[model samples]
Target: MASRSSSAAAIGRAARSSGLPRRNRRRVRRLCNMAGPDLMKTKLYSVSPPVKAKATNASLSGPTRYSPGMSTSRGRASRHKKTFPVPPAPREFQQARSRATYERILAAALELYAEQGFHATQTPDIAERAGMSVGGLYRYFRDKHQIFRELVHRGLEQNRQAQDRMLAAAEAGLVAGETDLHRAIEGVVDWTWKALHPTPPDLLRTLAAMAYLDPAFAELTEQYDRYERKALSRLLAKLTSRKRVPSPLAAARLLDLVVPNVGIWTALHPDEARGVKEATVEMIYRYLADPPE
Candidate 1:
């Protein structure tokens, strides 16, 4: 009994010294009292393992050390979180979708640029007009400049195609001997007037402004001018056998200016469009038939 009391007393002292709470100390004392001396020693030793004091100075003097294969919160988050790659769409579907998106973005950009001017227009405005997000717009165009380039190029291509078709029709008419000088002259004037006036005045004004500021636009304009001049020269060659003007090339150039001018005049004076068209056709036919001194 005395030996058991001694053991219980020792455990109580040890528990208190080890910073155990008073309640825990009393519990340990009761447990120790219930056991034999040898059992009490084993139970006490098993319950109270030796606790090494933490090296506080190690933390104060150096950087925190983590065990090998351990990761920090940031590192763990990065390791577990991944960005999955986007799978590519099927070839045909991808191509069709791309072409459709390209056209939509181009059309939207053209309308916005025409309305707002190139410098004043933004990508978001274009995307919204096209019914897409800004990021979706970027999938087709790298920037607004790219969109502008594509829009100008697309317009130039459409103009080229229209001119080609008109030239082909004129060539066919000439070969068939179905178009006389009067009809040919009238056709040329009517076509030129329609082409120039089809585009809105504000859109033409925007293009003119852009041509001044952008070298690409200027170059495109020059290319189109060259093409028109060439086509007009070809048409004139087929129409006139005699050199009615000082130079056929000069005549073509002059007619180009005169045709567009008549179109602009008609636009400014819509009520006089018929009179202007007839008068302009007469002037061009007379000039082709008889050269001015």
Candidate 2:
């Protein structure tokens, strides 16, 4: 009995050594009891090295290493961004004073330009007349040409405003059943003659010369001419029927030519200025009243 027990125990030990399950080891024991220890002795076994589990750390998986020069997410965004300069706002008083200075400069330049003529006038002369340093004058206007351009622009603007007011008054008068061509011609001629009377012949000649010489002045003169023509056309349309004068544009052009020459003739010959104006009014009225064959 002791010997049989020892044999079964040896078989179970061998099965366990072979990496068999507990149930399989029991079955092997049973089989060993039946088949004896001879099978167990025939099996060969070898030992394997034990594997150690790696140690897990929460801090090791937490974050990457931070270098000295490395920036944070927000800092990195700001580092590559560009900044721009903002201009200071102009004050109201400063702007007003600037405008006053500009007007004063322009007035002085016009006087100098009128006295010395545009081509003969110098920047130093303009600055002295303006009662400002050359540098101060330059702050308002770049050069003599620029000053002349401004003067021309101012004169043109004034003339345009005057013409517009006159046209409006004429339009109002026409709407109120006033249709006397002779009276209208007299009023227009007198107004234009007076406007041109203040302007010196030298200044007028200088302006005319610039209109021919300078491209800038030529463009300005053309613009003023177009404006005047349009205003005249409006006035003519009110006075005459479309059937009688098919194109007011043509009539306006002819009238424009007559008026300026009259103004120039009157300006040159002040002694006969009134007679020239009355004759101009009569001639223009007659031309409009009786169309040429």
Candidate 3:
């Protein structure tokens, strides 16, 4: 009986000691659960605590430097050449958007041609100014010369129109108290001034200089001069009486020499050519009214 009791007491003591460790372990698990997922995972795994924390941090931290193969904010690279954008044409035309295109091209060409000489003014430069391709410019004009010809024609036509108005005003009795001869001379001078004063003085100068080089240019210039002379001659013929009527050819030649030559001089040497206007009208008056002694 004594031996059996002693064995039972030994067993009871072993159970109490084991139950104490299990109760302590359960309490530890409860505390870890209260501390949150991080603590719970750290406690559940016998891992080095910091190693588990670091792994958890990495997993929860979204994308960052350590992420696999991340993309950056830099722009895409292109394979083709970089091209410039073409600008809109300077002038707009209603009748011929195409005609407007041509005029815009011619306008730009004339500006460049005046600023820089004909040889220097390339179609590419003009095309750049017009905001078009060189190929597109060719569709409108065959060559630079062709464009020049048209520009001159347009300018001359504009001058002719203004002359027509002046003549009408004269016939309606609006002269500035001058003789019919002086009135005719005044018309010529006024038209010449308007022509010379256009935006680019160089264009007309270049045209005149080019005439010496190119026969076609020479012919074109002659046509314009002939138109001027013809207009003057017609005016003189209308104004002069049967007896005093000066020769139309002579009068035209004289007026042409007086007015255009003055413009040419002024264009060539703007500094030396002041008072051209008043001086020209005075000279014309003296040449016409007071014959050379």
| Global Cα lDDT for candidate 1 | 0.68
**Of 2 and 3, the candidate ranking higher by TM-score:** 2
Can you write out model 3's per-residue Cα lDDT over 150-238, one digit (the tens) per residue? 66657666666777777666655534555466766676687676667654677767767776765444554566667667866766676
What's the C-alpha lDDT at position 232 in model 2? 82
**lDDT by residue for model 1 over 34-140, one digit each (tens)?**
66578655643644533433221111112223432233554334333422122223224357778888888888887887687777887799999999999998877
Pairs with steric clashes in candidate 3? none
RMSD of each: 24.8, 31.9, 31.8
lDDT of 2 by residue, 1-293 (tens): 76667767776566678655577567667766787645545654222222332221111111223332333553333322322112123224468878888888888877876778876788898888878899998887777766665566667777878988887887788888774677777777876877788998878877777767654456556778788898889888778778777788899899878898779877978899877777788888877774767
lDDT of each: 0.68, 0.69, 0.60
Q: Once model 1 is optimally superposed onto the true structure by TM-score, how far is the C-alpha of residue 136 displaced, in angstroms?
A: 1.6
Candidate structures ordered by lDDT, highest first: 2, 1, 3
Winner of 1 and 3 under TM-score: 1
Q: Which stretches of candidate 2 lie over 4 Å from their true place?
A: 1-97, 290-293
